[model samples]
Target chain A: MDLSPSGAWLVIVVASLGCYALKLAGWAVPARWLEGERLQRAAVLLPIPLLAALVVVQAFAGDRALVLDARAGGLAVAVVLVLLRAPFLVVVLAAAAAAAVLRAV
Target chain B: MGIGAAVGAYGLSFGAAGVTAGLSTLQTCALSLLLFTGASQFALVGVLGAGGAAVAAVAGALLLGTRNTLYAVRLGTLLPVRGPRRLLAAQLTIDETTGMATAAPEGLAGTAFWATGASVYVLWNGATLLGALGAARLGDPGALGLDAAVPAAFLALLALQVRARSTLAVALSGALIAALAIPFTPAGVPVLLAALAVVPLILRRRRET
Candidate 1:
């Protein structure tokens, strides 16, 4: 792959700064603002959908249409492991193994 | 737990991608250490891989990173830093760290949050360096479906977050937005959209009480 050195560096710098800014914004803001009843309630519930959407996209979206091949299998295995309340290490290894098998076969 | 593992593994793939994108081992490690944001790093590399303009890729990453603002707010309260600790704590703040911290029982929240953040930082940078060095021998992560690891891991994380009452609405909205936007948007954009879609639901839920 042909990567431009200067270009990549620039992206890294800007992205890092942007990330820092977001973190700073939260810290710099007054605590009372976020502690409001309504915002607090919203915060508790917000990760659900945002994380759900991420899961769906990761499991299904492919270069073409949705693929239920190896990736999906890996996801399924991870889901089962999670249900069983397995340790994080086991779940990751199992998911990766499932994905590898599905992709190979 | 699931989200942490899955998201962490995604770091491995990002490491692999970083190597393929012509980043050296040191540079890749630096990226993970400095940026520490998976979505942004992935977006940066994805754009490079696709021959997209560098500036556009950076912009895409910045846009995706907007969600961290939300995380920072929640985590700030749970693990408020004082004196010089603030600087280190701020660097450690990420989705996983913040999530673990915010979810933790009050007294234990600070410790759990720091542990999670430190662990992720160590694991991510270590894996990236390893992946960069091993990329050649690794032989096609796509063929191995390593890319799937990210979404799979994220899904597991999402599953853990589900509870009663609001589960249906949150799940449906996330699925709808992700499915619709995945094809149109770039790598980090879908996550941003997912975050944006939740805003109205959050606002509406607030109004109900």
Candidate 2:
């Protein structure tokens, strides 16, 4: 489980290759195989939970504990900006700024 | 064009966040160059930053990158080219490019795809280099709240995908699972396990159909 700095290169190479392979598999795999309703549905549905989990982990998780730190404030700002229909850049920057301001105060 | 710029702009955050997460500037820029997908890149660095194992980090990133495969499936029929061009097409089959390409008029789809992909590629990589160098120079990233910004970026990325009720349900379920698992599981395990939240939605869709 432990990864040294040098091992990171291996991870980077492996992940980049794996991701590229996934992208290529779509192009190379038979169109018929992918056309199945269930397969396509799964493809479309998969990212939802993964992304949501990422948001939760990034915002709330800390050292194996669910700690609501400054990151939560940042995410709250991001939610508001998303609700207000802010552009992606604006939402991200605003969240960082909000968290920074909160920590400063 | 505007969309490419908007998505490219986020590359700066990726750069800063990557360095803040302890990646070398070269490693950070290499991610934008190679992985290209924002969420996957972030997941990799995010896990590494949290002191997770490399395997878990790659697993999370690869899971996030799976959507690009679906994007390629949809784009394969639209832009038909072979040899090296197909390789290039696969590399460029990301969210912004696919979105732009799919939405374009039939004759213009190829142009849309290439232009958006190229612009995003250039701007994203360029911004990544700039952001990484800039972050490296910054003595302490926490002072600028970069830690908080990383999750914020994830939220921004997720917002576009949660349009429908089922997707919302899946997202909430995933969030709940990750939150519950955080206390007991390792750093990236929760994210991977939360993907199981989609199983219920898939079952429901099959039943309704």
- Model 1 earns a TM-score of 0.70
User: Model 2, B1-209: lDDT tens per residue?
Assistant: 57766766688889998998889999999999998888889989988887788889999988888878888888988888688899998999898899999999978989999998898999999999988998899778777888888888888778888898878898999999999999999888998898899888778878999
Worst 10 residues of 2 chain A by lDDT: A1-10
Binned by DockQ into CAPRI classes (incorrect, acceptable, medium, high), candidate 2 is medium
Task: Give the per-residue lDDT of model 1 (tens digit) for B1-209.
Answer: 66655655666666766765566666677789888887667656654554445665666566556556667777776765787777677777777887788888869988988889888888888777776777656777666655555555555556666766567577678678867876787554554566565577667866887
Judge candidate 1 at residue A34 and give its lDDT: 63
Regions more than 4 Å wrong, model 1:
A1-8, A36-47, B1-27, B37-85, B95-120, B183-189
Worst 10 residues of 1 chain A by lDDT: A38-47
Most DockQ-accurate candidate: 2
Real contacts recovered, all predictions: 0.56, 0.78
Predicted structure with the largest lDDT when compared to the true one: 2
Residue B157 alpha-carbon offset, candidate 1, angstroms: 2.7
DockQ of each: 0.43, 0.72
Per-residue error for A89 in candidate 1, Å, reads: 3.7
Real interface contacts reproduced by model 2, as a fraction:
0.78
